[model samples]
Target: MAQQVRGVIARAKGEPVRIETITVPDPGPGEAVVKVQACGVCHTDLHYREGGINDEFPFLLGHEAAGVVESVGDGVSEVAPGDFVILNWRAVCGQCRACRRGRSQYCFNTHNARQKMTLADGTELAPALGIGAFAEKTLVAAGQCTKVDPAASPAAAGLLGCGVMAGLGAAINTGGVTRGDSVAVIGCGGVGNAAVVGARLAGAAKIIAVDIDDRKLETARGLGATHSVNSRSTDPVEAVRELTGGFGADVVIDAVGRPETYEQAFYARDLAGTVVLVGVPTPEMRLDLPLLDVFGRGGALKSSWYGDCLPARDFPMLIDLYRQGRLDLDAFVTETIALDEVEKAFERMHHGDVLRSVVVF
Candidate 1:
């Protein structure tokens, strides 16, 4: 039988989300039902509310989630009941060209449950990121559940489902930050701070943080940024160049996703240095850079999708690192909120008042 559960849903564009009695169906073949323990309030949810992602209104918000498998449909051998796991948006289809090429991180075809979770009136709700999890229970493709250390806090572990993973992957996976490298992360939001922490984890000798907010810069410092640049007062590119021996950083990441920040990141790196863009940008945003500079400056210009991560491989390792005190996952959780508080959480996130407001079930 389908389950009736309380869930957060954005009924229309630019409207506040509401808690609705949602219907989650039993898992079908290749799918599993999970009891969500925690779901982080992410900017993406707000974007969905604002119609920024797409016209996929009546969105079931919240994707950064961790939970336990409650049931599985036939042929779902990947995850069984009682398995503690993090929900991932991208469940790679092995036959996709990207997966077949072994770059499953860029999997063209990802999996989601075939069944739809609906409102009381039988209106279908489009799950945010294909893993709507702002409820106590949600259904997902069996492959979307990545088993992790059960001892880890659900609030912390759930973050790997999205933004945090994007930031860390921006530095470690996309930017290829290495030991002794000089890295500069522009924008000290949750994602940018994660980049700072990831740079530290990657053994970066210097991590230069840039942001307009001093509070965010301080947070970045706490997360292992070696130097801070208040971009409001200082020219971030010049400051980064000065911090990195007047030659700019080896790798510069733009987590802000704005063209201005992207331009700063482009010039804030050494010639032939990498620039990883992990920030989500609006469709209307355009990049107008010099073609000559693009050719002359050299190095990789990359955009990270979900941090170019393979959830099954990265989630467990990162969780273990968190458990061992190597990764400070707890630091990212600014507050624990109830599901109903999601709308207010969006307000705080908009004002840069919190790094992450997590919904603890």
Candidate 2:
């Protein structure tokens, strides 16, 4: 049966999102309908609203979500009705060349549901990141539903779907942070702080948090940063280097994607060290660098997409880590809000006031 549910939708470009009735079709081939329990208001949602992502208006905003599978379509064996799951935007198609090469993390043919969810006026809503969970219920590819332990709270566990996973994955996967490594993260927002936690989890010996904001640096410290550097008062590169035997950190992650931050990350790592860029940047942004330095600083310069996460593998493990009180995922949830509060959440995000304002359905 076709179902109509209230969802937060961006009706026009640069306009605030409105909660409207959206018609979700029954689960089609390899799709599933999930009853959204909670969804985090991510920067990507705001980016879509501001036309930064594209001209896809009337976008259904909300991707970081957790819920229970309510229905499934043909050939959907990944999950079944009543299964508690975290919704992921990347549902890898195993036949993609990237997946064929055993690097499913870069799966070129990731998928969403084949069906289009539309408004009551019959306008098709392009869901943000292809998994719109701001609604009370949403339709997505069955593979997008990653079943995790039900013991975790929706507000806490749902974060693994986006920012948290991206941060954790940035350090553990992209940075290859090893035991006894010295790690530093610039711009200690949700993603950066998660990297701090991930570095700690990876057995990093010294984790340094760097940010212009004292509050964020303190927050990063709370999340497992062994040291904090206020970049506003001190040169972060010099500070990070001083903290790590004057050789810079082994792994330096830039959670703020601005070119200035990116350059800082480039020079703030030790020789043959890794730099992970987990932040999003605008198209107009550009950076300048010495080609010789790129050759001299001989290590990986990598960008982590969703933390190189395979939701099926990372989400469950992260949830269990949260359950065991190891990951401290709950600390990332600064507030719980309704779907209508998304715009306000953006305001807080812009001000760097809150880590996350999650929407509880």
Candidate 3:
């Protein structure tokens, strides 16, 4: 039977999201239905509503979520009903070239549910990142549901579903940050701070946080930054270099992906250092740099897609770390809100008022 659940939906572009009754269809082949317990309101959600991602109107917003699998479809073996899981946008298709090469994290053919959830009038709605979860229940590809330890609270555990994972993965995976390596992360938002924590987890000796806001910098400090630079008040490159003994860090991860910040990260690393870009940018945004500099940089300049995460592998590992108290995933939750609070949460995010405003169902 189809279940009608209260979900936050962006009925039209550039308009506020509303709590709409969305009809969740029964799972089809290789799909599963998740009973959402909590979902985080990410900047990407707002971007979808603003038409930044696509023209897919009437989007079912919200992605960063954790829930229990309520049902599964035919031929589903990756996940089963009643499993506690974290919802992910990246569900690697084993047949993709990337997966064929054993790099499932970069799977080119990742997918979502084959069936669509609809509005009361039967208009189909596009799920954000293919995992619309700002509701009591959501249907997703079975591979999109990564089972993890159920001990973690839904409010905190869900963060790993998106921004938090991106940040952490940028440092640990893309930057290859390790013990004794110095890392400077540009941006102190949710993703940025997660990179901070990721750096710390990887045993980075020095973690420098660069941001325009002081409060966010403070937040980053709590997340495990060894130094904080208010980029609005000073040159971030110089500050990062000064903190790293005037030689720059070993790895610089751009969490606030922009051309200027990319440049800052490019120059803020020591010789043979790595620069990782995890922050997303607008399409109109482009970067122009001296070709010589690109060649002159001794290490790789890389971008982290969904934090270069292999959900099945990384999610369970992270959850274990969270349970062991090594990774402080719970600290990332700034506020807990209900389903109707997404629009206001975006406002808070705009002003940098919260690290993360999670919707607790």
RMSD of each: 0.6, 0.7, 0.8
Give each model a TM-score: 0.99, 0.99, 0.99
Q: List, residue by residue over 228-320, the lDDT tens digit for candidate 2.
A: 999999999999999999999999999999999999999999999999999999999988999999998899899999999988888998888
lDDT (C-alpha) at residue 153 in model 2 = 95
Residue-by-residue lDDT tens digits, candidate 3, 1-361: 9999999999788999999899999999999999999999999999999999999899999899999999999999987888999999999888978989999999999999999999999999999999999999999999999999888899888999999999999999888899899999999999999999999999999999999999999989988998999999999999988998989999999988789999999999998899999999999999998999888867888999999999999999999999998998888899999888889999999999998999998
Candidate 2's TM-score: 0.99
- What value does the lDDT take at residue 258 in candidate 2? 94
Instruction: Report the Cα lDDT for candidate 3.
Output: 0.93
Ranking 1 against 3 by lDDT, winner? 1
Candidates 1 and 2, the one with greater lDDT = 1
Give the TM-score (vs. native) of candidate 1. 0.99
Give candidate 1's total backbone clashes.
Answer: 0
Off by over 4 Å in 3: none
Candidates arranged by lDDT, highest first: 1, 2, 3
Q: List the residue pairs that clash in candidate 2.
A: none
Steric clash pairs (candidate 3) = none
Error of 3 at 140 (Å): 0.4
For candidate 2, which ten residues in a row score worst on lDDT?
A: 10-19
Best-performing candidate as measured by lDDT = 1
